[model samples]
Target: MEEAEDDLALLVWGQAEQRAAHGDPSFVRGLAAQLAGRHAAALEQARDYERQLAHVIRILALTPGRDSLTQLLRLLEDTPPAGTHPGLRTSFIASLLAEHQLVPDLVATVFDRREWEKLDELRACLFHELLLRGADTGTRGPLRDWTHVRPGWHPLAWLPAHRRDFEADARFPSRSVRGSASGVSSQLPATGRLDPPTPRPSQPSALRDVATVDVHETIVAAPQAGGWGACGAWVFLLDHALTPEQVPALLPTLPMACVAGLGPTDRFEVAARPMDEIWHLLFETASMGGSHTAGVHGAYGRLWAWRSMAGLSGAPADAGAAEVEQQARQSTWFHFEADAEWFHNDIGSDYGIAALSPDRRRIAVLAATDTD
Candidate 1:
């Protein structure tokens, strides 16, 4: 009998998914409410076993709500699922809470239930998802609060201090580039001439005396994970301040170690780009990793990119994103364009961005390609 009931629940879930896919939002919502009510009834009768719990989870994912989320978290705490990978379990729960816009509530519940100690995996996953979502939507109030109360190391602990850089509106005034295939032009001059403008007079004359520095020595550290695909950063110090036009000339001088798997730098067509485009790429890369995997590396990728740029620019370790943007604005920026096939063994999807520090003492280049 229980087998038949589980089968029926699965059938209902399939139908609900179909309804949702077919644009029948009203039907899906109505069915979700009905199922939630049944789940609530089961809870009141003290018969809310695993089967019912699974059924409601499916329904709530389709139509997430605060009450449903609280109930699910409480049930999981009371009767943890056996034989489930904690990362997978918590990642799914985090998605539901993020969808329901209940992240703050989840944080409060963690505090109320003292789940941080008992459910460390869930806590880490939830906080990381919050950071990814914050980057996506530019919402930081919850993140600010989380940092103050967050226990132990978090993937995005630097966010609160650097919040100003991630502000989508102010820092990225031009939405022209996001979500458009041609947002960033791939065209480069046939001669590869960058045609850089004269260095601004405001730049200090002292910058001319700075000595060349090794690219690797200036970066903080590369991300330890692989999902980011062919990632690397380099810093170039020069006797004269670096300019947008100077990037192509410096490309060949990059340590073979820096450009090895990325293919010859000559094949990459370069163009000047705004600061907004680079931030979009960083945020998008982070979002992609988190969406595809059940790890904290996505947030790490974003943080590492920011930190690398900060380190090269001589910004204080705790400098906000806005301050970094301010520094970048006074410097030169460029984007490198190439076909994914241009990379070795035809690993498609390549992106590269470089910036000269406002002081012109350093040029930081960050590049990555996605295998997926």
Candidate 2:
């Protein structure tokens, strides 16, 4: 039986490779379509195998000398804009870019045009991959073009100028904190004002350098695990619906939080942190479990012990600290440092939280307002 199973796997892999080469969309779409419903472990194993095949195809296609970057970019732009198999093609292009270390050019081009589109997040993830791989590489040349585009307001426009600030926030510590073997029940630090304002990062001079009086600066929320970490098990509250074009603006606000829409996660236990956040947001939408009104009575039910609400405000004095804590757990305010866009292109609606149910429908969001 073991031998039979191994033979079956090889047979399937061969067919997939054939389909991938023919620019068939079904094979890739099928994998992406299965992403949300399956158990986490199984899904990850499948993606790893798929990535291996993708890399093999990319390496084989590279020409000896003529600008490989140009070839890769043409491959990306050539993908069908709207279709069932678009992801497969786009992901194929993304994999090629990542494999060849073309991130700097990718980022520079995106901002140079301020071209926000359906795959902006994928590009952001690519930029993130570049960030992780190119830590030692200098930013002067790669990002120089990006700075001249918007100077301010464009997300990461200040990246060239504020390279250090971007670097400091993006770097997550590797030290692990004590938690469940699953890493699910780890206790996160309480969300409260950090005493002594997080020192403001040096602003770029407008005259001598590109600077926006509107530059946003805030201390990153305490590291999830403290050494170097990404956003985990946290809730985001938004006032309105988001669109694809708005994603880059929103991403900078979440400089520390890594989500499925932004990029992949390095953690072994999770496929991508954003997926978990989306699932919980979906669960919240379905259960309406996280919504609450102002005051003590609204703090009903047990909150997830591990997660912290960041922007919740306005509690009555008589409500005991425990009650306020409970309230926060339910409808804590989330403070976004900047405006946002729809996280991913697949999202269906803006009415409530932008997530899909187990069946892939739009999920609900907390109705509590800024004052609540």
Candidate 3:
């Protein structure tokens, strides 16, 4: 593992040097400023570093080796050799570390440094990298097992991604750049459209009844092409009947007035007794204000979700949603959001805690801006 990690580090450093040679010198300077605790200068150089950091993260993510884990942890430690390393390289190493499921470990590192709140940008960069990789950030999911002892919100942790999606909605233009808000399309709306259908709350209700619920379910993500464009969707399959006890865990923090049925294919309706209650219980919170519902996602509709996160810098990841869903099965999912770029044209992006059962059978998908 040590040898492999050394080789991995060399590969990353080599790439960084190559990038630095061709890229702006300010990027490297930004790293030095950050290391020296020069916030203003670091912020000024953020854009230059953004591209380089993103590049390193992608390369490291694709590089296969369990040794990367050891190196990642080592980089977090403020040891002698690492202390002597250049700030740019250190930041790049940190970005690589963010590519995996190590939130608890990373947070612990921050705490150990006694710089919990000071490393907001570092944590932000890591969180953003996790999003780019489609990696489950151990912030709010079942894997998240920390208590909040701080005064304000979770320090250094951003709000839930789904909540950020809604906040971003208020900034988006009602109509998309290519289509109307009504989901009109030149081709078949089912197959393609600029705007796709999204689920919404059927009615409003009280808040006390709304709470996070968990249901375990399988979600299959596949590449989808439609008249609108290319995107993806989660084809969820329930193993057994959903119980009322497991409904709220899957829903958002909004009120649910009705129940809906969603299948693997693009067929959704007001689900029958147990299923309707199950979906309603899970999605009602999410449906209160956002475009969350148990609606069938069309190939075009998936594009809307894709657009929601279009501002995300790195290339779209090929990580399996099914794998993420499996992780949700092992961990818990709750409602959460994050800060995002100001895009007035975003459709939707699913970013939040999933309410999944302990067995991973019932899943409440609290989507960000898009629905799948």
Listed per candidate, the RMSD to the true structure in angstroms reads 15.6, 21.7, 20.5
Put the candidates in TM-score order, highest first: 1, 2, 3
Question: Runs in model 1 with CA error above 4 Å?
Answer: 1-62, 75-92, 102-147, 152-155, 161-165, 169-226, 252-267, 290-302, 311-331, 339-348
Off by over 4 Å in 3: 1-49, 57-108, 115-117, 120-268, 272-372
| lDDT of predicted model 3 | 0.32
Top TM-score prediction, candidate number: 1
User: For candidate 2, lDDT tens digit of each residue in 36-139?
Assistant: 33447676776776665445335432332335554544444554233332123443344335444445455555333433433443453343334433433245
* Candidate 3 lDDT over residue span 1-372, tens digit each: 122446545644665566688886665554444445544656657755655554443344334354544343343343312222222343334444543336556545533324343443344445433443344444564223222322234322322332222222111112121221322111111321112123433343233232212111112111111112222112133556555344432232233221123212221211112221222222222212233221212211222223222111111234232333233234333332222221112333323323444454444333223432
- Which is superior by TM-score, 1 or 2? 1
**What local lDDT does model 3 show for residue 56?**
46
lDDT of candidate 1 over 105-217, digit per residue (tens): 66566434244345555554556555555532234454445556666465455444333344343211111111212121223324434633323122222222122344343
TM-score of 1: 0.54
Highest lDDT scorer = 1
| Stronger candidate by lDDT (1 vs 2) | 1
Worst 10 residues of 3 by lDDT: 214-223
